[model samples]
Target chain A: MTKKIPVLFSVGWNACINCGACVAICPQEAGFISPFDTIAVDRPCDIACMLCEAICPVTTITHELAPLKTN
Target chain B: MARYRPYFTLYLGSMDKQYDLVIVGSGPAGATVGRFAAQAGLKVLIIDKRQELGAPIQCSGAVSRHALEEVGITPNAEFIQEPIYGFGIYNQIGDCTTIDYRQLKGDEYGPEKGKKPLGYVVDRRRFDRYLMTMAERAGAIVWLKTEGLGYAATGNGHCDVQMRRFNEFLTIRTRILVGADGLQSQVGKWAGLRTHIKITELASCLQYVVDQVETEGLLEIITGHEWAPGGYAWVFPKGHGYAEIGLGVIPTMTQQNAQWHLKKFMEQSFFQKRFKNARILEIQGGGVPLASPLRVQFADNLILVGDAARHVNPITGGGIHTALSGGYIAASFLIDFLQEDRDASAKNMEGYQEQWLAALGNKMWKLHGIKTKIFHNQNIVERDQQLYATMSDYFSPHSEYKKI
Candidate 1:
């Protein structure tokens, strides 16, 4: 059974300058900034990596640990 | 809303027509190219991802007068905030080595042709708007709120570009696709070019535009691991008591984010004394690619310019001059490439890369090497005195880093 899992979320505390830093650095292509420059850097981010959190220039992204459910 | 109505449908209509040139991103680089190409009679279309061009202020707005003049813009009060005469380099403990530009000697990054003042801090929004305006006035159609999805070679000396505005999608068939989008260039990536900077090669920066902080009219550059590891902070005077206090840190080297480091840096007694009663105006964050310039900046009628091509100086994180120059080179080449009936193969586009290398790419590579040796040198990551000595030696226009 899976145990600890990392969940990603936008801290939402920082303003999205729409700089596209996170989108450029996401090796997994888990994030993107649209033409409208929306705050969907991680609209539905799946955490294979937390590079977005580490490299967000404004510190607007981070991760949390969650216990995995098993049968 | 200025951004609504979907430009994909409004401008191109339902017809599938091919433009001579299509540029993504309306920043200095994109607009410069658009202006030149359109003025030369190329059917040009420039698209921007934002509703209002130059909104959200993603840059520091500092550029040499030569940068503006090179792009054919005259320096005036409309955008010039203040002119800097020199720099004051400081270390972690606040040791300062102030140098006046008139008294200094350096190999490059010097005052251009005896131009007074090293550079001017600008209102980036106004400056950016000005460039885009020039592009539109030169007959290039400017479409806001349009995003370039990707592009592909039609395999017939033309390329197809896909873009979206709101919920609508449109395809722009063009002779050449120009990528001027910022550091993270999805278009360049689709063209099979290296578009992403290694996390270690990235400099994450946060800045606060505040009033009542004295900057002594000189750009105050601060260094040291305690404040900014693998990068540095600066205090740029905006005129009269307003200054932008900002710092950049290598994401991979620091355990803390830019905000955390900024907070710690501000909490220092030195900053506390200086920032007392200061009125906070605005806060901004951005990232600068501190890697070597991208070697292959073009592919099969697809070209990358500005930060999209990683043209920024690795040591100083400055891109304005290179962006304007590179945009000009790319546009000039595209004019001849199209008029001379040249094929769209990557080999044919080699002239753009060669011209850019002789003009600026070589300098950028040298800066990248020096940066790796000084700023990101893991061996001296914690050595304060040694770090400041080398950083100041290379960074100052008055001092030569080679002597060190």
Candidate 2:
């Protein structure tokens, strides 16, 4: 059986300004910013591109290539 | 002939003349890339079709402050007018809301004092010339009145470009080609890349730089079905008692000319009641691509930048800043390719795409999609009105209101 590539994702909490530009520009409809809820990254649909980082005026979004390791 | 010693080197590579890079257009994208690369000691050449610089300005000349810093250019105070604190967004029904990007806080938001301008409203002709001058100062050779007719692959990954400058057809051999030409770019089509922007996704625009108009400080955005179906009208203050008044309509919405509609809008009750008798000093018209974001930006030894690659932000129909950002990325990638001593192939260029996509492309895609749904929705007007109705009691007096 061919093994599937495990998806990886990370967003820096300190860097998120809740601009919603990411939510607006994600082609896959995967990025979202909500006033009442945390924006979650669904690995299967996430392309791991950080276009949100560039357009964000506040420099709030930073990405880590691999998912954070659980202690 | 005296003993021809097989003059050519490699399968198709020729070492006779080499340019570190060749950018097809002298617009924002090409100028930015040329400046950055030439500053780093790369042989860069930028070509433009127009005899004079900044002729026939296509854009509305709006860009964010953050975009300027990314390209290492500082904004002069004289260029800025109407310090945009926020956007006053009116819906199809004439009700409105405001989104304050300034409140978020950053260098882009201006100084922490009372209020500095969010960004400047510049004369594109002067601005484009300024950027081109910077590129020239950085050692990039600029050829004006030159048209890029076509390009041929020189066996290897390099290319032989055929261009006409001042009635002279010249062929240039370059290591890499950057397509910064705006929409209808022949460089993009010649590369076999899909640069075709559909009519439905295009905005036909006409703007008048009017003097003696009371534009005030606020950037006025008039929204309604009757005003502009798929696009909106803007009144941006250009300081010195003049304002840039314009309206854009989606191509499908109008078989009638854009300039004619603009004249009607000017005469209409909504605009003419106050700013009557405003003299129009200049009239400009052009196309703004609104296809959202493209899926790919590179192929073979070529890379596309600015409108040539469809990098315009869908929500605002603004691309100057984004294109400058793209220029920076393209220059960096070219430098890396040279350092690696590898011919710029798809694999090498893929890194450039990934870096940009990771930075701006994916978000542009999402934003464009959201803009499509919101702009095209039947209930958008009512929904926005309802949101505004509840705003009075929802927040403190000190807090700012956000409108989309």
Candidate 3:
């Protein structure tokens, strides 16, 4: 059986202001944002929880379900 | 996503922990309430999602001396960057106006006649940690890097709060909950409180901390449509050749965002030369709600304070003082409700709203009106100049502007 993962929606990077609110609020530490850059500090983990999306002040982060491929 | 379900279930096993009050966010408001409640002997727990107590700084960190006094905080030398005595307002057309603290009247939160400093620019990161230390000393349990995910009001008036600490899930049972989670509070949403602020009522802001910059003690405020269409730009000195340069804009009024305006302001002839050799230390940005307080801030087993309650000053976008006051006020009411009445029902918490209104509601409403008038006019620079020039006469010393 293939597993599933969470991915950043298309609008995530463009809409993100790099406020780090998403990074702070993410329960699984899925988001990696930095004040020095406009992009994510690290690739977000595939945590299914949408806390980052729910807590984004600008509604910048969103997520979608993706299949996890077996090696 | 499905791969994480089993991990979630593994962490869901409840660890028995309970408190009389649980406050979220760990900012000034949460720390203040936690300190007061713990000092009064209540079992209090305060949590913040941030790894550091105050990181990814969101504020310009200006607060009046009286605001500090009202919350029982003495001006600590370590965190105070500079003492401000007045403001220097400049227009795009090169008009200037200055308002001195001495010209202002005394209000409930104003300094005494002989007081030399009207306000101080602070290091917010240090200041917030200092407040958390106070709460810790007073016996409040603080959990850094803990995010409050959601909560459910148990039928008996207690709330079961679900939280995530890094990868671990935990549950906390509390008699009362306070949401100090700021402008986009998840706590407010989970509590079913009406916490929405219209887009027109929000100010999007961005700032840069520059070192080796030339600055005087007085704060410099620049205004004009060309500078910041719906708001203003400020250069607040942090002493020893450091300053915070920032601007705010109402998104609805301008085609450009705050960052665009800030860049434009920096390139202008007046500031370009000064910033040429200055070192950019850090960048900060966030949104602030510029509106009246939420009509309903209390629900069954819950209360909202600070920016979560939209307690920011509508005109100045200042919230630190109000957050402190609101936290202290909420703590008082919670003490009365929990200790005196031995109840934490929504009904018992109504006093929090009532008392807060008596303290700040009327003033905030009036400022909202003034802010509306100021922002709607065509000549914001001229109107702002006139307003500041006559502020000593038009507003009492107790005005929100004085404290903000």
Candidate 4:
């Protein structure tokens, strides 16, 4: 089993209004609305930098600590 | 040198067109001025960076009935969501004090007495579009997705405004320029207008449009450090089951950010249960100036209004009324000056500041004083308690609350 990070990004897709405010205010460019008009996070997320979480107008983007997997 | 020559040559001939007046930003302030100026037969052009009239909505969408009427706007079903007759103020510990407009003393309720609604929660997108439409109908040319990059005074009573329309670069000349852009206005800076508000005078806010919120026709305001340090949280009901729940905070007063405060507020004992069955429909955030208007709003051939001029109520963070009123005031002066063929210099435009001060500046200053005293009180609980205790005094006809 491969070791995975203990945290993951979760998006409440239904709550997103596709306002693009998150995209404009995010300092890391970590989050954006897809061409299909849905919220999407960039790959290899900058977990330490929480600017996306802080600036999200709707609190759509959040993080949850994952349980450690046993090998 | 040859490669750079073509681009430099292109810049030299970029001036595209000219207008009598150029207004930037299509919010209520800009649109209001555009409408009045166009109606007066002045060649006007209004531009906004947004593709749509109202995207990434920044306001809670609450406007007083009087404010709408003052701007010559009548509330109809298309935008008015709910009519609010009163409000409730709450503390961190779940203590609430309610104020009913009907029970208030004196002429504060206007001539309609108990019949009129105190305020209304509106669909901000539609409302902003309505204002823009009005401007367009009044003969103002509106350009969307147009951003003002910078400007230069041509020194001949006109300015050359550089702009970017989507992918194209362009410039428009205008005898007079108006900056109605919201907080963080670049126009104010480009015009060399001294309109800087201290960081402590700004409120960072975040709000959500939610469904399944059960409430009467009343606005809810929650205060205290736990709710929002140096500011307050609000729940403006938008008819049916939808409501706008948001809060603002002075950045320097709290280590935690507005997002943290909002999340904690949603999970609070009082609000957690209410929001459990609720669904958030949209999210919006922006900064508001909680200070007095700028001392100087006019420079040579330029004027700043609305949030760009810091014309927000420091205590309540309300700017729509002032913005609308300021737009009208600016138009009245601009129309007179232009019609008389007066030079659009700083001295000629000084009347705008004087007229605006006479209209709303004193009220804003008084509110700023009250806001300072309230935020300075160290004990949150005691402050709220004292506020609740004095809530009745606000209903008095002679009270300063009546002025607001």
Highest DockQ: give the candidate number.
1
Per-residue lDDT of B209-270 in model 4, one digit per residue for the tens? 88988877777888777778767788888777788888987766777777788888888748
In order, the Cα lDDT scores of the candidates are: 0.77, 0.65, 0.74, 0.74
Error of 1 at A14 (Å): 5.4
Ranking 1 against 2 by lDDT, winner:
1
- Order the candidates by DockQ, highest first: 1, 3, 4, 2
iRMSD of all candidate structures: 2.4, 15.1, 7.2, 6.8
Error of 1 at B369 (Å): 0.7
After superposition, candidate 2 runs with Cα above 4 Å error: A1-71, B1-17, B77-85, B92-115, B378-404
How would you class the docking of model 3? incorrect
Per model, state how many residue pairs clash.
0, 12, 2, 0
Top candidate, metric lDDT: 1
The i-RMS of candidate 2 is: 15.1
Which ranges in model 4 have alpha carbons more than 4 Å from their true place?
A1-71, B1-16, B102-114, B386-404
In model 1, the runs with Cα more than 4 Å from the true position are A1-17, A29-31, A34-47, A63-71, B1-16, B102-115, B379-383, B395-404
Candidate 2 vs candidate 3, DockQ winner: 3
Please provide, for model 3 over B159-261, each residue's C-alpha lDDT reduced to its tens digit, 9 standing for 90 to 100: 8998987667989999999999887676877766776566567667788899978876667777666777666788898866789998877677776667778
Give per-residue CA lDDT, model 1, range B1-404, as digits (tens): 45565454666543435799999998889999999999999989998877776667767777776677876888877777888767788888888888766566443324456446667898878777888989989989877778888887888889888888664688989999999987777778778776657888888888888898887657778888888887888889886568998888888888888888887887783677887766769888777777889889999888899989988878777778778888998899899989998888999988889988887788778778867766544565455666677667764654442211
lDDT of 2 by residue, B1-404 (tens): 75443433233233234687889888778899999999998888888877665566555676655577768978765345445544555544445555454664544455467555556676677777788989999988887777787887787768888887667577888888898877555576677766655555666667788887885455667665466656677778776788888877664565454555677677773667656877888766556666765566787778888877877877567888878988888888888887787877766787888888877787777667755665555675663443233332122224321111
Give the 10-residue window scoring lowest on summed lDDT in candidate 3 chain B.
B390-399
* TM-score of chain A considered alone, across all candidate predictions: 0.51, 0.47, 0.56, 0.51
